[model samples]
Target: MGNSSSIQAADASGFTQSRSLSRSFFGAAALALVIILPGCATYSSGFAKVEQAAAVRDLDGAVKTLDELKLTGADEALHHLNKGTLLRLQGNYAESNKHFDIAKELADKLNAISVSEQLASVSVNDTMKAYEGLPSEQLMLYSFKALNYLQMSDVDAAAVEARQFDIKQSQIAKQNADAKYLSGAFVRYLNAMVYEAAGERDSARIELQKALDGYKKQNSGFPVPASLTADLARIKAGKPAPSEVVFILQNGLGPSLHEATVRIANPNPQNGSSLLSLAVPKLAKRSVPVARIELSAGSAVASAEVVEDVNDIAEKSLNDRLPGITARAVARMVVKNAAVGETKKRSNELGAFGLLANIAMDVGSAVSERADTRTWSLLPGVINMARLPLPAGKHDITATYYSESGAVLATRVFKDIEIKPGRKAFVSDYYLNPPAQAKAPQ
Candidate 1:
């Protein structure tokens, strides 16, 4: 939904002007703006190849392709994040945390750069610049890092990551107080689970309450999870049990970014009334693998509920970023217009060369006007979780990933799941899409 107003905003009186097209270099500049800029790379489509690998359950191939990509600056952070997520899926917790830690550091460093970087972007092309990640993606980085710690049974590190998630969520909320929607229940709930695992009942109870508040704020019509309610009840009864197993399910791929072209009217209305265009990023929806998951440990069975809607997170994060994007686009257009106007004021041979040079620059800008389309493409469209209490010993749990129609998509039997006394077991899985249900990139 970015820069949707580019055309309407350009039609304002500020862009209306009368100029001599025959004598001035206005004709060439207008022509360049109209023809060259629209040819820019609107969005990158190479991620489709990785998705293709994933469709056939080729995890190693997906990671290999993603790793082979040469990335620089902000894109490097995305590289780390995406690879870390894939590694986690491969059950490489230690290696995954290493990459995720690097990603977190890079994200902070890139985000701290001054907004002035956008000015440099006007001339150098936006795609050449660093890629500061979306807030939702940033938050997910921490969530995954915590999950990595959980898988390794490092409660201390996991708790630290959970605290960082809370801090980041608060910061995002403060930045976008007027946003239409922004809330995440899973992070806090997971935090509570970690605290409970660490034998910190008070902190666990507090986090559970916070998680409940987040659900209330969402107001998205989802019922409060009965599992959460039961956990809270047990915590209130001074039963800080560690024999519980939590299954974290990541389901499907989130939406991808695309480009939309906005046609702006010529600044000088007399120049054949040609239209100039701007390219802005947009989010395109896609189908997810499953809506809910059911976990069965012998006779005890429970259904996983949505803890995080990654699709909504991506959409909200983009909407929150639209204001800054629109402002930068407006500023860049103003600079282009001023450059063209100055070219017209001079009447010497050098001025004629200046006009040609400006035309060339416009063409370059058009070629480089690519949208920052890098994201954690392998991440699930939604995250769900189920908790089951079991006796301290090796056990078998079967997880059934299914669709809204109650159709069984995939059934995974996790054998020899070990539960320890006063320590919980964490299991994780992701379903990109049911076999035979994969859709080709549009």
Candidate 2:
């Protein structure tokens, strides 16, 4: 919370309630702050109309709604990220990349802030600051940008993104040695394929190994794709293998943050049933539609398994930062309590004006206690991948995504996929669960 001192605890004891001013005038300023600003707003409520459109696969409508909202300030980065993903899903790769570029620049600028700089903004709340994005969101920004390039058949640009992501994650890993989200194994797996497509076998092999090491090192709760092992072994033999079809699937929606308020016990029981309520952000997991993706390229088949669980990474990422968030909240509440207590003290002496002042102070304290819930809400919860090595020729590929309960949720088919010798072709998709079917009575 920044600039919280703007609310002074001092009383205007001499201000007359009768002929000097209308009774309503006394509370106007305080009421304005509470009424005019979205101090207690959450992401879900703000994005409700747009999300409703997206829930039904009306992506164009969703994009249009977002455009109409014209969100600004700290959340502009997330707005761009949402638009970019929606556009990508619509197969608008160029436009998607343009928006992603804007988001990347904004995030990079915010990331330049030092710890001291952040501490200086202690009085400024999260809603007022530029969003730098969480580690998982930042990582996916690179991944989606690369995927957009790949969709446009721009292997070189994709490779460039791969390298940049590698450098970025390396720096992140060094700074946060114990952060499991630093693994970047999903992105590494993707980069390996990008290198392979670029005819950089040595770089491809190296990245594949790095991906293996990252998966093991991070222990991110996702089992390494068994296909990765087969990939490394085959590449190690240095044989000129036929080109392959790599099916990349982004599965289910990612988790979102919601406010969770906890009431702390009173240090002195005489004070009442509660001391203060601490508001914090908590991850709300999204639906899990695609548990496994079964892919078949003619006779050759491979099952795409989880390379990354974004929900888990996002949860762990937020958990790592909660201590600092909690501490700031505690400090902010202390400031609010002092202001409220001051108003309460002068309420009797100041008469009607003081009572109104007390009411405003109480409202301000509750409104200011809201938790920040912004996030890259459009991202998928899981990244699933499968590889099929076919002889250099045209082949038919079928991909079917399943739920954990083994129900078929979706199926995608790519016809006449051509694979060249010593190269890789990719077929990628994003999936959401079909409308939940009505169940029969038992």
Candidate 3:
């Protein structure tokens, strides 16, 4: 393609020589879209600075960077999701939940009908529409909310969030009856734990059974922890623990996204829309640095078992929705072709400007054919848990993160971790194998 400014100058000189005002206006507008729109960045690309800050475990810096991106209305949902995560990591549960609540509300609003965004999605690109997080992501959002509430020492709010997670997961499961599910065993287990902590044995028993069933049903490339079965039995037989410490380990960064483009002939030639390419989002799975986290307190030691594989769930969720995503992308290509053809027919009235319009539309379409790669990128790749029964007392807590090889990766020490009688102490941590490379751009 020739330089846009040079071509525009040449076109303008011709228009001025002919003294055609109408042609000049149309040429200016069409060429502007072609030149300016093509330089527009994808949603994922805007996160470079945010990812860099987050990689260094600078939660505040990451949030600031994300806020500085100055995203559009379409990016509001993702902005809140990212900020919520950053705040959540900062241990500011209140602030995190505030952003998360706003995010959830935005997602709900986005789900409602919006003809302009919908049309734009089909004609320009998927990112034209407001971001609606995947089902698994919504679940994760709820899980995070529940965890935030738990961390705030509000068992009631946590239970409510947990129940909401279950309800939403069940609805999604019913809708995708044929497909494998995330099963949401972790949330159910968390609900049970919350109940147990609140001394609600019956409710705990019910959620525990569901959790046990969920783990058995889910194949997240991890074995169902033996503790779940034992917990079920103990709960059923009314064996209440004296005290416990539940470790919730978020392992590695969640899979981010990248675009995959392919040029192919229009599938439906009869539609009067000729197109050559499609761009769709694909999962960019990150490497897991730590296989599991081991927690040791005095003489008692337990390894947190993987319960949810965020990578696997994200892959499955995208696969479940790929056909629709690709269909929209194909439709976008067709619309672009149609637009280019229409531009050629209308702009021809301007003589030389017709070719300019054609070039602008063609190049603009090619450049704008990016996939909607927005996602909750800061989520954990895998979730692991360990319920260790300990006597009520202060003890030095040591957490060791290990690699798949038996090599130690990192360790954390929490001095004077207190376990109260008949109460559950919660410990949560996030681990990224190599923090700096967590969200390396593709």
Candidate 4:
């Protein structure tokens, strides 16, 4: 975007700003380096334990492990997101919303940090800073929070989240309208359902249309649910549709993050060409088959189909970020290499003390080279949904989880679920096959 000299000048400015933030720069930097380098991988092992607990359907064990996480600095956002989702799956709606609310606030604060933080990251590593969260994760905060409100029968609160989701979508559009969806079709669909629950059919119809239009734009190869179309038709004709039992399914585990290396050619060819590389973390998709669920009430049965594959959403969201990540990594590498060159030049001029300084800088560089691999890892691979109309009364419903090849894996039965006339009943479940190896971020 500018000449090489100007870019280097900007880097120097960044360094100056970072230094101005502290009185004891060297001491603070050293302590930060020590704390961050070792603490970066702290959550991985603990989250693995949480994953193990979740695998066996031990909700209490999962919560216990989650509560034990050493959440500080960049770990805070990820910790809240994971803890919140886990609690939601565990049927702790109010508690889950509390965590999610904290996550949203932290994410907003992180996203609004000073430019000096960006510059500091060049030398200290991104993980040494706060986690700003992925776009998908940010949108998901509202989605889940809205669902939590719905579960509590607080339709007004859920509508607030729906409005917030729209605001985020508008901001994303302003930034880059041509980019893929900021929020997914499923979120919009949920918004419509929420509006409908609040006796706002006109608003619901509008949201339903947006949902249909957004899904078409997503082009994710998933067809619009037949039942959704029927609902839209009924809403358009002003005919009241039956109150239904809705299942929001989180199936399998989401992708995991790992590190990879990228090499950049020397920017200044006259200084003798060299290859510079940085280890960058990226999301690696774990293969999990698309999931389906069958809901049965006595002899009548209905199938739950995949409406939103969150794994696909995460993949696309990460993919959209690849260009920005590469650019930032390249810029950071350039700044760090320049710092090394400056230090080496001073070392040659000042003898022993400068030599020690240069050595210390080298050690810091090596230790701080890791990629930022933090995420809300416990998210489901896919989100399947189904709506079944039931007469206003208490009824027993059975939900069967199935694998990709139509093999039944597990079944859960809920007895005496009460459905009120002209009102929606909500139900949800999580199911996955056990992982072959331990994974973190749940």
Candidate 3 has its poorest 10 consecutive residues by lDDT at 266-275
Q: Please tell me which model should have the higher TM-score, number 2 or number 4.
A: 2
Compared with the true structure, all predictions reach lDDT values of: 0.71, 0.74, 0.77, 0.74
Clashes (N, CA, C under 3 Å) per candidate? 1, 6, 0, 2
For candidate 4, the C-alpha RMSD (Å) to the true structure equals 10.0
- TM-score against truth, every candidate: 0.82, 0.85, 0.88, 0.84
lDDT of 3 by residue, 1-442 (tens): 5699899999999878677745564764565485337338755687767766766677788888888786888878888898898898888999999999999988777767499988877877778788878767777788789888887788898878876777778877887786555677777877887877777888889888887777777667778778777878888887876587877877777888888998665565223233467889888888877876789887899888887888888988899889999989878776677766665566656656655655565566667788888898788888888777888988778899888888887888877778888877777777765544444545
Q: 184-230, model 1: which lDDT tens digit per residue?
A: 56677788888887777898898888778777776545666777777
lDDT value, residue 318 of candidate 4? 73
Better model by TM-score: candidate 1 vs candidate 3 = 3
Give per-residue CA lDDT, model 4, range 252-343, as digits (tens): 78887776775566675223113455767777766554366889887768888777766777777778777777777677666766665664
Best to worst by TM-score, what's the order?
A: 3, 2, 4, 1
Point out the worst 10-residue segment of candidate 1 by lDDT.
269-278
Alpha carbon RMSD to native, model 1:
11.1
Error of 3 at 347 (Å): 2.5
* Per-residue lDDT over 65-154 for candidate 2, one digit per residue giving the tens place of the 0 to 100 score: 888774657677888898998898887899999999999888888888767546433432445556777776788788889888987889
Q: Candidate 1: where are CA atoms >4 Å away?
A: 1-44, 122-129, 179-183, 265-275, 341-362, 365-367, 434-436, 440-442
RMSDs, each prediction?
11.1, 7.8, 6.3, 10.0
